[model samples]
Target: MDDERLRPTQLPLNDLATAYVQAGQTLFLAILDDIAARVRLAHPEAAYLEIGIDADGDVELHGIWSAQESAIGTCRLLYDPHDDPEQEWRDGPLDLDELVDDLGRVLTGSFLHHWGVVEPHPVYEHRDRRWLVLPPADRAATVAAIVRGHVPDAESLICRFAERGERIAVGFEQVTLSGGGTISVPCPLCSPETEDGPWPRDVSHELARILGQLYALPHLRGRHLTPCVDITAEHEGQLWQLVFPYRDHKKGAESS
Candidate 1:
């Protein structure tokens, strides 16, 4: 019955809402910028990319595409990380190649899985339909190349391998670096019989070059988390394994 009782209280709800919206916008923009930078680096010709998060926490992309010199391009993309056969394509079409560069590699997947905060139990193997295995020594060098952004000794050799459509093979030798450290490099021609043998000087150098490209990616380079991987590679129907920085990296981060 009283006039004061009938009126609404003047709470600062509008200010509170504004603050939350601004904070959310900042976070969304940061994530988009990160993803976009990585995409552009991988596809230098990428154009008009737009990534954003909606109010409901849905991440989205727009105006992105890739060009192929001799191949027809797809107009749309399927953004599902798990590669679900039943998943529908995203409303927006991005360059599939660029998107894969940003999210498909093991190092990039690990980065997004750990930092994107979008899912529990991130699925890295979804992209691992094919991978390589290398000895621990090669893994350690590859990891170093990733962080350093250049293959130590095989720059020319990697280019040669690239020109010839050859790739480094991974091996399964049971070796571990002191402190669990590992490295990576691009690879040379692979041999199933010699999977466990040490890489030739040329092969090691080329592998380093391949890893150098991965390390140079903005998402992987700028991330605060140190990545350690079990390296695997795919090349011309050959399957091999390599090493990455996992246990040793975490231990170092924790100790630091």
Candidate 2:
């Protein structure tokens, strides 16, 4: 082998690795910015964050949605479409509160979100554990509101029973939009940027999936493929500004 031909290929770790990470971050945010343009237009001060790929090739994404909020929140809405549990409830009242608790646990277990490149099969229920039926339609909004009030604000993730649909999808949802559809407000698949990917587009992929779940809830159906995006920004100490663009936000790139 020629003397130069045998030179070792550099690995990502220190400076180069950090630089690679920064570059990846830049790429991911650019894609999200392009995607976000479909949502709220643009902000000169805002930038969506991109947590770069992990050493394991795993990627987590985060995005900031508004000028006031620096964090992009991810929310999921869940409702058992199968009325089995509800039907059982029709028989009589049985530990419904306990059932809600159990159901919450079941949904949290769905937290793994994305398994990446592999088949997206999230374990919905564990041994002896299944979803608990929600209260009657009249009380669902109340329950959802209470749940939201109790959850940590930093999570930017909300789960509620607002829609009349049978799909549980996670999305980079807009808090402001009144109507729906490709032309009205840009959703994940609705955007032109939607395409095949292993690129930072993976971030977009994950974000859209989660947003889909949040948008369609209360009447959640039987099937789901969890989509997650991870993005983190390190500050002083181990603290970091994290955004899960799964809300479909791109905090604008840091201006040079």
Candidate 3:
């Protein structure tokens, strides 16, 4: 058989990608529903929940309940993707019993009252899916860490742009596995004050490239699979709002 003839066509590849994405999305949503049910049962007043994974692969679940006073409690869980080959793309464990117990203990303990008022992050609806946006401070910190770690030169260029009163914004408007992703960066030179100086298109492009890679970072992707609905950053007047392509096991798993 000819090697070229044996190769899969683009349509088949695309179909495979779509199927993989749907599978991951379905499993993720099911897990979210389970978590919500478990948490609500323990704390009937629980109105909001946020799950986050840190660089060390530790999973933290935070639940908030409102009565005359608002209270927040956090519980940590271990998540090792290597433990389950069948569900490697998932961010947390398939089991929720341990997680629920942990949250229950914390919410009932004295620690719950110490934490100040807890505010829920804004939620955005897209089709049948709803995702929470990270707080601006957290989002900015994460973006800065990613850019500095991946694209070192971006930090300095951003600083220079800030000094000159020019802002550089790098973000993704959309990304798809089949390819034609859109990266959004407002033109710094277009600003009246920046017209007198040169714009560093190279740095902007590099920043955009690095931002696109976020979809593949396992630690960043929470239990929801999609990290957040939007990631925005601001440094000395420079602001960025990034929305990367959804990554499924088809590409994300291979990269990981």
Q: How accurate locally is residue 224 in candidate 2, as Cα lDDT from 0 to 100?
A: 23
Badly placed stretches (over 4 Å) of model 1 are: 1-10, 48-64, 67-256
Every model: Cα RMSD to truth: 21.4, 21.7, 20.2
Better of 1 and 2 by TM-score: 1
Question: What TM-score would every model get versus the actual structure?
Answer: 0.22, 0.19, 0.27
Question: Whole-model lDDT, candidate 3?
Answer: 0.36
Candidate 3: tens digits of C-alpha lDDT, residues 1-256: 8766645677898777766644443343334334555544544444454544346544455323333242463322223224466854443323454764443433332222212112333334312221221112223344554544433333222221121111122433222222333323344544524432222545445444333222222343342133233333432343323332222448756887
Model 1, span 136-255: residue lDDT tens? 223234554543343222211111111111222222222234444443332324453444433455554454444433332335333422333323435333222233334455776899
TM-score of model 2 vs. true structure = 0.19
Number of backbone collisions per candidate, in order?
A: 38, 34, 0
What Cα-based lDDT does every candidate model obtain? 0.36, 0.29, 0.36
Better of 2 and 3 by TM-score: 3
